[model samples]
Target: MRSDRDQVGRRIVLAEDGVLLREGLTGLLHRFGHQVVAAVGDTDALQQAVAEHGPDMVITDVRMPPGYTDEGLRAALSVRRVRPGLAVLVLSQYVEQTYAARLLESDGAGLGYLLKDRIGDIEEFAAAVRQVAAGATVVDPEVIRQLLRRRRESSPLERLSPREREVLALMAQGRSNSAIAEALAVSEAAVTKHIGNLFTKLDLPPADTDHRRVLAVLAYLRGG
Candidate 1:
């Protein structure tokens, strides 16, 4: 729950083909102090809304339009290419790691992938919107689980210890070091060590400090 003290209302453009879900989401976001500038039903309308509103963030369903396959996801990728730093939170009915990984290929900040049916708590959903709007990564836990399972035996991720894997999974979820530490009930120093170990095990050489986590996640997504 957000209080007046730290409330950050974001202007959002919502794209969900289902009329009920789109309206419901708009109302829910409104109740939490977010302004849904536009609620659209298809990829074309979604793109138009983004162009017209220039929202702080975009919340879109995976399947949409006449094809109803991945038009929404593709349009999202396209819009991001044009807008660069625009925040995107993809909501899908199933876990589709391929498209998810493609979306993550760019900067990982302000990116989120979530399953529609899996979001049970309204508060957490709202919090996820806020996080993504503020340039944080927020992936579904189910996505993380299935993503980890796809790693092949020959993959470099096979070298990770169980604890290190846990740290890596949480890292992919965009949890900060302190947040991962608290979630694992360990010291922050322990989480740092686990992250360093994962970096070495994954063969990620020293690079831009801000993007190291994103590189590590890309490695995990590439199943190695």
Candidate 2:
């Protein structure tokens, strides 16, 4: 793993409704060598900060003031509309399949959704920030597990072989074929074969640019 200093100096805009957490995150970002160009506490202010600063990344809580029902996530989505390809990392206290699905509906590049509990691991949190800024997708493992559990009873994913299911779960964690193979103690060719089979079973079409792995993960989350 690269040190946080390896990806230093990224400009970030942070949005969190809680004052203490916001301050703590701001300090943490600084300690990790990134600049918090703006740190706001509400959806409106968050959008304003992103628009005004045009930060490299936006780190926001899933809920925020003024309804607090996914306002922060909504605001992040809106920012993406205006600034396509902008990196966003949403933090949530719990896994919400709807929220995760909505965020992953399009290309998953430059997107991340993580549990707030991950903040306890500073190195991991910093790594997620760097990954998002570098145009990689990152989703919490627990989020994937929760989504799978919720749809386990009648999910099309049930059609998958155990190894295929394992491959899909690793894909949901944003692992590449090589990484998944290494984790599973299999050859890259085997991992690719499993991924191809899973894509066929899931009925995902190949795209020129969009990642099939991300689409497969989205399909899994949607219970397809």
Candidate 3:
């Protein structure tokens, strides 16, 4: 059994339009030893909360406030421009690849784009909270599925073999080497080989300081 308390309490600012879900998520965060400095119901208030609190991370809805189209996402992007490298986790009712692409345009680190209803496990959500706050990228699997369904007519990903592409998609989901192997029912060594191949194909050289695995996924999201 994995524990949800694998990290210290992270300061968070939540932006959700629904009253019930906003309250529910606040309580959920509290259960996992987190502090929600502010929970706003609109884009303007959300930006204000970020500016004032300077929270360690923000969990905001993709749609918020009067317009309720992409206000929350746009605001998140705006806030990131001001506070570069700020950890953000945007929750969405539907999977929108454009939103994913737009969010990852600047930096892929410390980011999360998850569906509202697909977040079924409390422990996993807590883990995602920790991962994003710690500068790791955690993308929802459905988003990856949608990306996979797209025809890679011409892109950097065209160089990758089908297996390498499979490995890359799992990486986008933030899966570990062992987890990827288990998911694919293959050996860890095989997963590593596929990862190396994809990285080479994407021209991402190995760097101890750089998250090449995430960069590969970002490449896929960008134009692959």
Best by TM-score: 2
Candidate 2: where is the Cα deviation over 4 Å? 1-6, 156-224
lDDT by residue for model 2 over 1-224, one digit each (tens)?
Answer: 75654466789999998999999999999998899999999989998899899998999999899997899899998998899998999999998888987887765589999999999999999989988888889999998887777668456687789999999998888888899999999999999899888887877777742477777889777863
- lDDT ranking of the models: 2, 1, 3
Alpha-carbon RMSD, each predicted model:
13.3, 13.1, 13.9
Off by over 4 Å in 3: 1-6, 151-224
> Ranking by TM-score, best first?
2, 1, 3
Least well predicted 10-residue stretch by lDDT in candidate 1: 1-10
How well is each residue in 1-224 modelled by candidate 1, as lDDT tens digits?
64553378889999999998998999999998999999999999999999999988899999998898889889887888888889999999999988787777876589999889755688789888888888889898988888767745548889999999899888889999999999999999999999899888988887875588998888777763
Given candidate 3, what's the lDDT at residue 222? 87
Candidate 3: residue 207 Cα off by (Å): 46
The CA lDDT of each predicted structure is 0.87, 0.88, 0.86
Please give, for residues 1-224, the per-residue lDDT of candidate 3 as tens digits. Answer: 43453477889999998999999999999998899999999989998999999998899999887978888889988898899888899999998888887886766589999888755788788888888888888889988788666545447788898888888888888889999999999999999889888888888987851488778888988863
TM-score against native, each model? 0.66, 0.67, 0.65
* Model 3 lDDT on a 0 to 1 scale: 0.86
Model 1 ranges off by over 4 Å: 1-6, 153-224
Candidate 3 global TM-score: 0.65
